[model samples]
Target: MTDTQDELPQLMSHQSFREQAREVIRGMIVSGKMAPDALYSAPKIASDLNVSATPVREALLDLVQEGLLRPVRNRGFQVVIMTAKEHDDVFKIRLLLEVPSIREIAKSSPTANQMKGLYDLANAARQFAREGDLIAYLNADRRFHISLIELLGNKPLTELVASLRDRVRLLGLANSGARSHIVQSATEHFELLDRIAASDTESAAAIIERHLRRSRDVWGAGSGPA
Candidate 1:
């Protein structure tokens, strides 16, 4: 066979590899293993993940489109690094979109089953945090917060909030060493649920806003852009 024919199998294998590589990188971003502003090398990632360079390149390209990574001048891609001002701006917008939506759900007075599910998610998140399982904690925490909006019946708002929440996850992982913050966050969820259960829209909204703001504050203090 010719040289081109010799390369065909490797090319075909790579074609099937990029999809899985993309997912692995996305998971690392979401789980905070790869932090914001951290530099990434395609070859290094490929070696680490036991794949070829082709898939790593494809995965990085996908992340760039998703706004999770960006190219650096004459170098590799870096995690999308947000400044403090940018983080604050996003946090404010998130509060505007999510707090009221959560309040509306609170006002609707969801069934016991609905509230129980959220509580269960919160409990699971707390356990994950206590165990120092960052990935599990991140997933469970996302579920706990998004569950409130999901209960509100706002699909569009939920999608938007989820995107913004992805950015916040970076900050959360940066400051994940703060045990108090984790405990406080878990406790706040219970309080927010209590307010929701009581159908106190005003208090519930206030609680959520405060919860998000405090999280931003704590994470921002240490993890803000350098």
Candidate 2:
């Protein structure tokens, strides 16, 4: 009898807008435009994104569920950053899951079309990095890595890896002054693909191992551990 909007949430027609707002805000947080120390209001974010407040509210609530943010009652939400130990643990888990798995991709018969698409994403990622657009860079980088993981044909594995990636808190990447490191990291994508194409499994694995390490060691460099 209490199945009203008062007792349960509803998914209305504005789902796409909510998703858009969520992705944009998430990108901002991940890119370091929104610091963990600050509180952000849905109305304010909607104003900045030029959207209605309702969708932004829904998006903000979603982020709360994902643990990227904490609700601040009437004020808004505060960004949540992972502890150094948590970040380090996530990095170790990713290393275990991603590095060796790359060998399977290198051994598989990936189509030329697939490789071309990945190369395009790699180039886009590189350009985004060079321009210092951390949001765009992370977007492209996420897609590149996820796409590579998808080639393994394991949906659960793909989802697990993606979830792990999402667990990373924003490390203020935009102001990290990691210009040289990011550029070098972006270029590593191409090297990964090249190794995959050559069927050099061990080499691909090594590249990815180093690549994964840098996220914990260098992506947020000059900050605290991990």
The C-alpha lDDT values of all candidates are: 0.74, 0.77
Q: What TM-score would every model get versus the actual structure? A: 0.74, 0.85
lDDT of 2 by residue, 1-226 (tens): 1111131123245558898777767776666667788878888777666668999899999988877788998899988877767767877899999987898899895899999999999999999899976667777888889999999999998987876776664555535456766788899999999999889999999999988887666644455454
lDDT of the structure predicted as candidate 1: 0.74
Q: Write the per-residue lDDT of candidate 1 for residues 1-226, one digit (tens) a residue.
A: 1212221122235346786676556656755567565677888777776667987898899878777789887688888877777777888899889888887888899999998898999899889778765555666787788887888677888877877887765544445445677777888888999999999999999999998888777654676565
TM-score of 1: 0.74
